[model samples]
Target: MPTIHLRRRLVELDAQILEQKRVLLDLQQTRIAVERELRETATYPILTLPVEVTIEIFHRLPLEVGDKMGIRRNTAPISLTAVCRIWRGIALSTPTLWSTMNISFDDIPSTVIAKPGLVESFINQWLGRSGECPLSLTFSLPQLEINSLYDQVDFSIRRLRPIIRQYAHRVRYIELDFKEDTRISELELHSSPFPLLQVANVCCDFHIETRVFSNAPLLHSLHLGGEEGVIVTRFHLPWQQLTTFEGFIDNLDLFIVAPNLIDVKCYWSGRESTLGVITHSRITSFTIIRDCDILQYLTFPSLQHLDVYPLVTYDFFESFLKRSCPPLISLGADAAGQGFAQWHKALVHVAATLENIKISYVPHEVMTSLLSLEERPWLSPPWRTLNLLPNLKTLHLSPVYGPVDQFYELVRFLYARSDKLRSFQLEWFTTPFLDAWIGAGAPGAHEKADTITGHFSRLQTAGMDIYVGTPNRNYAAKTHDAADV
Candidate 1:
């Protein structure tokens, strides 16, 4: 009878324990429901808006580094998705947000680069999320330090070729940077045209022999750089469609390739390069560095803006103006310790149309000579000619050495062109004279400041905006408008 009573008690206790455990679980579930409801209430503000509006807002956010869909974390798209279930749905569905990608091998892990198949898989996933949107892709090849990993890089390129070819039709902008001798044969391997490609920036240390981009009809802007620089490549680009080109050209004559270019920024290395006997009629703007007598060789009739640094000779420009007769409206030049003779001649030709003049580092002697009152019978024809820059409106001088003490001459120059001079700015306009005048901490510092202020006060009576920066660490000076009292 006692054994039977114990067994019954034990069974009852087991049943009671199971009942308590079930009740505790029910309470815990209720707490979770309440917590979730509170969270939804807190996010009600953003959740209240339409999903479309939120997607648009997300698109306007700044682009973040890393491939969140790949190995990278905390990317803009990833963060947006992590916010809430609603946000995650919207972000994953928005195709435009995933349209631009930089697939660079420069800083990626060696393990990933070695496994070309893995890279292709990640890229495939990323592009799949983009949902057929036009892509802007930048591929940066590894530098020389990874030369030993040639086999890995080759494998990686081979893997990426098929993936890139699949998406080539949808790519609008493409940039490639190659630092090593690893030839990018993939560009040539694909025969299909890059139908939508508009802009291309190619930087390679070696000459690319393949005419890979010859069929890209819509391509327009091209920026080429590297040590060996650009030579006629096997890849024939549609040069006729190119309106803007910036790069180092091995050959001076551009008419063969890019004749219709409207804007050209070129670095001509060959000192004697006369851009072959070709005339570029549509070129309106030119920025040349390390230029020689190339200007004399080329004719630019439609040019409106000219910026040159360190001309080979004044005669080169003079002859160019005589030949081209460009209606130049704006001109910028670096004298590079040269005399003002060349400038005077160039100004005489463009004075009728030139409105803006920005000269960097003109010698003090040149400034003094311009402001000098002495008459020189043997001076250049332009110097003898009064109102040299009759139509000049803005004059900006950026002197390499500070405190260009040509203030008096500069003011006089302004007065000469007071009829048309609207603004005059001097960068690094400091002076040891002013410091000495102030005596640093001398007793007459206030008086010195007043004296310099008075000099400028008189100049302000003229009708031009004058801006000068004091010799200080911070360039925080304001313009002293001459028109204002």
Candidate 2:
């Protein structure tokens, strides 16, 4: 119906419009994909954090986390590298992430037994990634049973010795775990002074020759434990400057060598003999395990914290306290081999300065007797005394087996210190019974829970922090606990 040129122009315009529509559809699809990706990327905080902030986040991870990753090499620095290009750059530059290298021969796969060079290369690469940061190394080799594997073990040790020698100057902490039958002579590193070393936690099967650690000027903390026991005569630790020592020693006189020690935790069994008197001025904390008769001979003038189990005797502890007369701030009186009532008298000696007290595993009958209104009505409660730890802030006790009246006694005790008391915690020795009680909707469980919660609320309102729940085993173990201390 139209002229020829007009018809041709109309067809060309239609094709141009169709082509533009195709291009518009492509743009719409691309915009939708970009918006979806933007939403996902926005959800991740790491994406928005600066590189420095991200690096610090990784630094705040526990040192033990790296120790755990020693068993699985692919999870840590390696796994972190796989996240993204930016993260990979940040992780590689952060030397602290690689500074703590946990190397256990147990982690070596049997598949790599023949390839000792591979093991050597791996260690070199791992430590090399740390750049120049101070190292915390934990090297452990399992006790070998098969005599035929000695050559292979020697090969790995030979490879490792060179690396240790290279980095010994930078090592801040070195924990060595080896068996007694281990061929100590093969390593040829018995005399090396760790100039920068600060802590050594070593477990050995044989005598650790004093020459093995010639002089550690900076070394302050040492934890030595093993099955054959540590031979103190053969160990020449820098005792004069030592601040913390934890071990089981055959010779009890080793305490005399460390005058500047701040903390001492040991296992001693000198039952019949009285070791001569020893005095330390700087010691602030002491934790003694089984059979500590040596406490009779030692005096710590500055002790603030004391944790002892089955304390030699009430008389022995009182005598030790009198001799040391430390400015007592914290006392763990769990398993004192006596009742709370007897220990209460001992506390009076330091009550003027004591601030925090933890009591656990008290005999049920004794606890009941201590709290009974009728039994010791004459003796005023500890709270009312003017000279007895008026500034006391925290009282942590394990669950006591007694009546509701006995429980209320403790509440009253905290109430008396409500003005100054900051925290009052009742920790469970075992799993919390409240969990199961609340789950099953037991008849009296709600009432019991409400009563505890109400006390917590009142304490909070009165300017105290209250925690009534299961005990954190890690925190208890570090500070003090009945079973562990």
Candidate 3:
């Protein structure tokens, strides 16, 4: 009914109205989606992050404070799942977060040794979450002598044995500190090949049938921490496969059997028996936490590190060095009543290759000689132009005895070796004189004291790593305090 131009204009106006409606519908849908996201953020903030990012943040916390005992339930990996449904999904999906567990039960903590099915359930649940990850399990079984207690332990072991057998192949490291009991055999079920087992620490005097693990291609470290000095022959270990051995054993005959053993650490002290001298070519590291002349009967040509509570007699040590010219890189020894001059006789043999020295008790002569203004003959043997401990880079002196005079000598000794020394830790700098002076306010020598301290400061400023006077490191105090003389 309108004019032609007006009619055409009206149709165009209708098309514009339809296009605007489509745009309005799209805007309303976008507003709903944005409001939904805002609600989610307000309700569960952590879930806003990708599930993978939240799981990674949880992994940084210590895994040791765990579900093995009820005491740590609040902090264990399982506790994370209980906090919220969001975290529960994240944790169960992470295998490595639950791969390690430390289970300790004995007569010591009453609450730790729980009922029959409880412990088995705890272990089963903890390990089942590990998926296919290698496990590191530290289990300390009950060391009970009471007949009643043994019954409880037997039941627990029987129930847990199947769980252990199922997961034994996944175990990479396991520590068994169990004493001999009826349940000990049940615990020793590595009778099945632990295909992934690499380290085993066993504390038992009973004949350990480790022969079962001999076929385990990856098992290489064995530690026996029994007190009875269990004879090596009694342990049917996979000696040929082992590269590291620790614990107490006086019998040196094991050296003959362990051709591949490269690291040996043990304690020895008793009647020094005259045994046939045995030599090993592959051992590169050896340590004795207790004093012994165990070195008298054994030798290692490939030895690179020697640490001992006491190297014992100089004659014995010198003789041992003469027989086996090891390429020693580190030396730690305590002078067991041996004089500095005598100890030096044996020490010079390894000076050529020694790069680290940790002397427990710095000999009186050595301390005095270290402070000498001139180079002493003791430090410079005529045999070679280089000084003693030529290549020494790290030195740890447990305690320097006598008075502040010996304490002052430390700076001089360190300066003497400044060319090569980069790290130094003097455990204790206290002496009777320094203690007395410090008690009296140290009036006259305050400036001198500062200067002496300044020497250590100067060394530190020169980029050398130096530390002195650590708390409670006073090994100079006599143990038991029996000798009041």
lDDT of each: 0.67, 0.65, 0.67
Report how far residue 474 has shifted in candidate 2, in Å.
Answer: 20
TM-scores for the candidates: 0.76, 0.76, 0.75
TM-score of candidate 1 to 2 decimals = 0.76
For residue 218, what is the lDDT in candidate 1? Answer: 88
Residue lDDT tens for model 2, 1-485? 56998999999999999999999999999999998788557756577787888877777644332332244332366667877777788888878788877777754555564665777677777788888889888778767567544354332455667778888878999887766555444455455667889998877654646345555688889887764345566765577777889887666556677777888888775544355667778889988777556677788889999887656476677778878878999887655464234565566667779898777665566455444532343667542232366768887666554332344554445555666778776654544322111111112322222343344454565467776555563111222111200
lDDT of 3 at 378: 53
Model 2, which residues run further than 4 Å from truth?
1-45, 61-75, 144-158, 183-190, 206-208, 269-274, 336-341, 369-387, 402-404, 427-456, 467-485
| Range of the 10 consecutive residues with the lowest summed lDDT in candidate 3 | 434-443
Which one wins on TM-score? Answer: 2
Residue 31 accuracy (lDDT) in model 3 = 96
Q: Give the C-alpha lDDT of model 2.
A: 0.65
Model 1 residue 170 distance off true place after TM-score fit, in angstroms: 1.1
